[model samples]
Target: MKAAVWYGKHDVRIENKEEPVVQPGKIKIKVAWTGICGSDLHAYHGAPGVIQEGTPHPITGEMAPLTLGHEFSGIVHEIGEGVSEFAVGDRVTVEPMIKCGKCEPCKKGYSNLCDYFGFVGLQSNGGFADYVVVDDYMVHKLPDKVTLEEGALMEPAAVAFHAVKSSQMKVGSKVAVFGVGPIGLLTILCAKAAGASQIIAVDVSKERLQKAREIGATTVINGMEENAVQRILAETGGVDVAFEAAGAEVTVNNAIASIAKKGQVVIESIIPHPIKVDILQITAKEANLTATLGYCGVYKEVIAMVASGQLDVKSIITNKIVLDDLIENGFNLLTSDKSQAKIIVSPQ
Candidate 1:
C-alpha cells in the first residue's frame, strides 16, 4: 500500500506501507477518497505539536511518525467481530473522533469533549492510504443517494454542524459568519439549515465568498474590500449570531464586533496565535461567547442533510489528487493562496 507518512514538521513522505487488517471490534475500509483538512495543514507546517516523534497519542497510545489523513469515505472491505450494522461492499464515512466512552464527558453525551478523544489522522494511521482500520463505532454507511466524494465531506460537514449546534442558533436569527474557508462555507450552510434568516459570509477571498453565496449565504462580505462591521449592521440592522470560521485573530474580532447587542459569538476557528481581545466590548454588549471543539454526535444528521439534497457539498470540493501526489498537492494548498474550496485525496 502507498501512503503519505508524517515524518515531522514540514516532513511528509510518500512511501509504501503494509496494508492494515481488520481486527476484532474494528472494520477495514478500502479508502476511496480522503480530504486534506486545516489541521493537517497545521501539522504539516509544524503546529499542534501532536505528531512529534515518541509522543504518545492520548487515546490510542500510538506514537508519532505515523500516517496522517482523516476526512475520508470508502467501501467496507471487511467487518470485524461484533460489527453488525454494516458489511462488506457497504460504502461509509467515518467519525474521526474516537472517544473513551467511560470518560465523564462521554457519560454526559458530550463525547466530543472526551478527555481521551482521538482524531483518526492525528492519533493513528488514518485514511491517507488505500486501507484504514477503524473501530466499528466510528463507521457509518453512506446512503445509496450520496456519492463517494460527498461521503468524504461528512467529517468536515459534521464539524460545521457542531459549530452551529454549539451556538444554539435560533430560528430566523441573523448570522454573520467570518472566514469563508471550506469550513466557513460549510458553517454558513449549516446555520441556514438551522434556521438563520440572514447570513453574512465574510472572507478576504472573493472566490471563496462567491462559493459561500452559492451554498446559501444570503450576504457576502469580502473583508479586504469592505468594512465588515459597518456592512453587517447596515445590511441586517444587527446580527443575532456571529460565527468565526477563519482561524485568524482578525476575523474572530470581526465576528465579535459585527453582531447585535447580546448576540452569540461562536468560535469555531483555531486561531494559530494567541489573540488579545477586547473583553470590555464583549462585556458591554452582554454577548454569549461560545467555543466549539471539533464535531460529535451529528454525523448521521449531516449525512441526512446532504442526502436530502438540502446541503450542497459539490460546490465546495475544489480539487482532487491521487495518493502519489498527496505531498505536493496537499502542501501546495497549505502554502498557496488557494483559490480552491476543498481538495480531495484519492487513494485507490
Candidate 2:
C-alpha cells in the first residue's frame, strides 16, 4: 500500500507500506477519496498537539509519522469479526473521532468532548493510503444518491452542521460567518438549510467571498476593504448569530461585536494560539459565546442532506489529485492558492 506519512514539520513522504489487516470490530476500507484538512496543514507546519507525539495518544496509542487524513470516504473491502451491520462493498464515510466511552461527556452522549478526544488521522493510521482499517463504529453508510466525492466532504460538513445546531439560530434568523474558508463556506450552507433568512459572509479574500456568494451567502463582505462589523450592524441591525471561523483575533472580536442583543456567537476555527478579546463587547450584548469541536451524531443527517440535494457540497470542491501529488498539488496548492477550496485526494 502507498501512504503519505508525516515524519515531522514540512516532512510528508509518500512511502510504500504494508497494508493493514482487519480485526474484530473493525472494517478495512478501500479508500476512495480523502480531503486534506486544516488540521493536517497545522500538523504540516509543526503545530504542537495537533498530532500525538512522544507519549502517544491516550485512545489510539499511536503518534506522529502516521498517515494524515481524516475527511475521507471509501468502499468496505472487508469486515472484521463481530461486525454485522455492514458487508463488503458498502459505500461509507468515517466520523474519525476517537473517544473514551467511559468518560462523563461520552456517557452524556457528548463524546466529542470526551476526556481523551482524538481523531483517526491525528491519532492513528488514517485514510491517506490505499487501504485503512477503522473501528466499525466510525463508519456511516452513504446514501445511493451521494457520490464518493461528496461522501468525502461529510466529515467537514458535519462540523459545520454541528456548529449551526449548537447556535441559537432559527427560521428567518439573520446570521454572519467570519471567514469564508471551506468550513466557513459550509457554515453558510448549513445556516441557510437551517432556515436562516439572511446569510452574511466575511472574508479578506475577494475570491473566497465570491465562492461564498455562489453557495448560499445572501451577502458578502470583504473585511480588508470595509469595516465588516460596522457594515453587518448597519445592514442587519445586528445578526442573530455570528460565527468566527477565520481563527484570527480581529475576526473573533468582530463576530462578538456583530451580534444582536442576546445573540449567540460560535467559534469554529481551531486557533493555535490565544488572542486577547474585547470582553466588554460580549458583556454589553448579553450574548452567548460558545465553540464547537469535532461533530457528534450528525453524520447521518449531513449525508441525508447532501443526498437529498439540500446541500450542494460538490460545488465547493475545486480540485482533485492522486495521492502521489498530494504534497505538491494538494497541500502546497491549498497553502498558496486562496481560490482553491475542498481539494480531494484519491489513494486508490
Candidate 3:
C-alpha cells in the first residue's frame, strides 16, 4: 500500500507501507476520498494542538509522527469478527472519535467529552493511507443518494450541524456568523435549513463573502472594510444568535458583540491562544455563552440530509488533490491569499 507519511516538519513522504492488519472488533475501510482539514496543514508544519511533538497519544499511544487525515469516506472492504452491522461494499463515512464506550460521558451521550477521547488522525494513523482500521461503531453507512465525495465530508458537516443544534437556533431567528471558512460556510447552510430568517456572514475576504451569499447568507459584511457589529445590528435590528467560526480573538469578540438581547453566542472554532473576552457583553445581553467540542452521532444524519437535497455542501470545495499531489497542493494552501475552501484528497 502506498501511504503519505509525515517524517518531520513540512516533510511528507509517499512510499509503500504494509497494509493494515485486521483485528477482532475492528473495521477496515478502503479509502476513497479524504478531506484535508486545517489541522492537517498545521500538523504538517509542526503546529501546536494539532499534535504534540515527540509525545504519544493518550488513547492510541502513537507518538507525534502520524498518518494525517480524519474527514474521509470509504467502502467497508472487510469487517472483523463479531461485526455484523455492516458488510462488504457498504458505502460509509466514519465518526473518527475513538472513545471508550463504557466511559461516563459515552454512556451519557456526550462521547465527544470522553475522558479518553482520541480522534482518528490526531491520535492514530488515519485515512491518509490506503487502509485504516477503526471500531465498528465509528462507521456509518451512507444513503444511496449520497456520493463518496459528500460522504467524506460528513465529518465536518456533522460538526457544523452540532454547532447550530447546540446553539439552540429557532425558526425565523436571526444569526450572525463570524468567518467564512469551510466550517463557517457550512454553518451558514445549516442556519438557513434551520429556518434562520436573517443570516449575516462576516469575513475579511470579499471572495469568501460572495461564496457565502451563494450558499445561503442573507447578507455579508467585510469586517476589514466595515464595522461588523454596526453592519449586523443595522440588518437584523439585532441578531438573535451569533456564531464564532473564525477562531481568532477579534472575530470571537465580533460575534459576541453582534448578538441581540437574550441571544446565544456559539463558539465553534478552536481557540488555541489565550485571548481576552469581555464578560459584560454576556451579562448586558443576558446572552448564553456556549461552546461545542467535536460532534457525536451526527455523521449519518448529515449524510441523509445532504442526500435528501435539504443541504448542498459541494459549493465550498475549492480544490481536489490526489495523494501524489499533496505537497504541491499543500504549498498552494500555505501561500495562497484567497480563502479557497476545502481540498479533498484521493489517497488511492
Candidate 4:
C-alpha cells in the first residue's frame, strides 16, 4: 500500500507501507477518493496542535508520521467481527472523528466537543493510502445517487451543515459567509439549502467570489476591493446571521460587525492565534458568538442533500489527481493557487 506520511513540517513522503487490516468493530476500506483539507495544509506548514505530537493521541494512541487524509470515501472491503450494519463491497464515507464516549459532551450527544476528541488522519493511519481501517461506527453508507468523488466531500460538507444547523438563522433569514474558501463556499451551499433568503459571500479572491456566486451566494464581496462589513450593512441592513470562515482577525471582526441586532455569528474556521476583538460591537448588537468543531450527527443529512441534488457539492471540486502527485499537484497547487477549491486524490 502506498501512503502519504506526515513526518514533520514540509515533510510529507509517499511511501509504500503494509495495508491495514480490519479488526473487531472495525472496517477495512479500499479508498476511492480523499480530499486534501485545510487542516492538512495547516499540518504541512508545521502548524502545531493539529497533529498530535510528543504524547500520543488518547483515542488512536498515535502521533505524527501517520497517514494524512480524513475527508475520504471508499468501498468497504472487509468488516470486522461484531459489525453487522455493513458488509463487503458497501459504498461509504467516513465521519473520521474519534471521541471518548464516556466524556460529558459525548454523553450529551455532543461528541464533537468531547474531552478526548481527535480525528482519524491526524491521530491514526488514515485514507491517504490504498487501504485504511476505521471504527465501524464512523462509516456512513453513501446513497445510490452519490458518486465516490462527491462522497469524498461529505466530511467538509458535514462541517458546513453542522455550522448552519447550530446557528440561529431561520428560514428566510439573511446570511453572510466571511471567506469563500472550500469550507466557506460549502457553508454558502448549506445555508441556501437551509432556506436562507439571501446569502452573502466575502473573500479577497475574485475567483472564489465568482465561484460563490455561481453556487448559491446571492451577493459576493471582495474584501480587498471594498469594505465587506460596510457593504453588507448598507445592502441588507446587516445579515440575520454571519459566519467567520477565513480564520483571520479582520474577517472575524467583519463577521461580528456585519450581523443585525440580535443576529448570531458562528466561527467555522480554526484561527490559530488569538487576536483582539471589538467587544463593544458584540455588546451593542446583543449578538451570540459561537464556534463549531469538526461535525456530529449530520453526515446522513449531508449525504441525502447531495444525493437528491439539493446541494451541488461537486461544483467546489476544482481539481483531481492521483496519490503519487498529491504533494505537487494536490497540496502545493492548493497552497499556491487561490482559484483551486477542493482537490480530491485517488489513492488507488
* Candidate 2 clashing pairs, residues 3+ apart or interchain: none
Collision count of model 2:
0
Residue pairs clashing, model 4: none
lDDT per residue for candidate 4 within 253-302, as digits (tens), equals 89888999999899999887889889898899898999999889999889
Worst 10 residues of 4 by lDDT: 52-61
RMSD of every candidate to native, in Å, equals: 1.5, 0.8, 1.5, 0.8
Model 4 TM-score (2 dp) = 0.99
Q: Which model, 1 or 4, shows the larger lDDT?
A: 4
What lDDT score is found at residue 32 in candidate 3? Answer: 94
Better of 3 and 4 by lDDT: 4
lDDT of 3 by residue, 1-348 (tens): 877777777877877888877678888899999887777777777776676447787667786566778988999988999998998899989889888778899899999999887788778888888988888888898888889998778888888999998886899999999988888999998899899999999998998999999999989999889899988888777798898989998987888888888988899988887999998989998888899887987776787789988879877888888888877785457347466788788986
Q: Which candidate do you rate higher for TM-score, 3 or 4?
A: 4
Q: Is candidate 2 or 3 superior in lDDT?
A: 2
Candidate 2 structure quality by residue, lDDT tens digits, 1-348: 999999999999999999999999999999999998989998898888888878888778788879999999999999999999999999999999998899899999999999999999989999999999999999999989999999899999999999999889999999999998899999999998999999999999989999999999999999889999899999999999999888999999999989999999899998878899988878888889899997999888999999999988888899999999998998899999999889999995
Alpha carbon deviation, residue 71, candidate 3 (Å) = 0.4
58 Cα displacement, candidate 4 (Å): 1.5
TM-score quality measure for candidate 1: 0.96
For candidate 1, give the lDDT.
Answer: 0.85
lDDT of 3 at 277: 91
Where does candidate 2 stray beyond 4 Å?
A: none
Q: Which residue runs does candidate 4 get wrong by more than 4 Å?
A: none
Q: Each model's C-alpha lDDT?
A: 0.85, 0.93, 0.84, 0.93
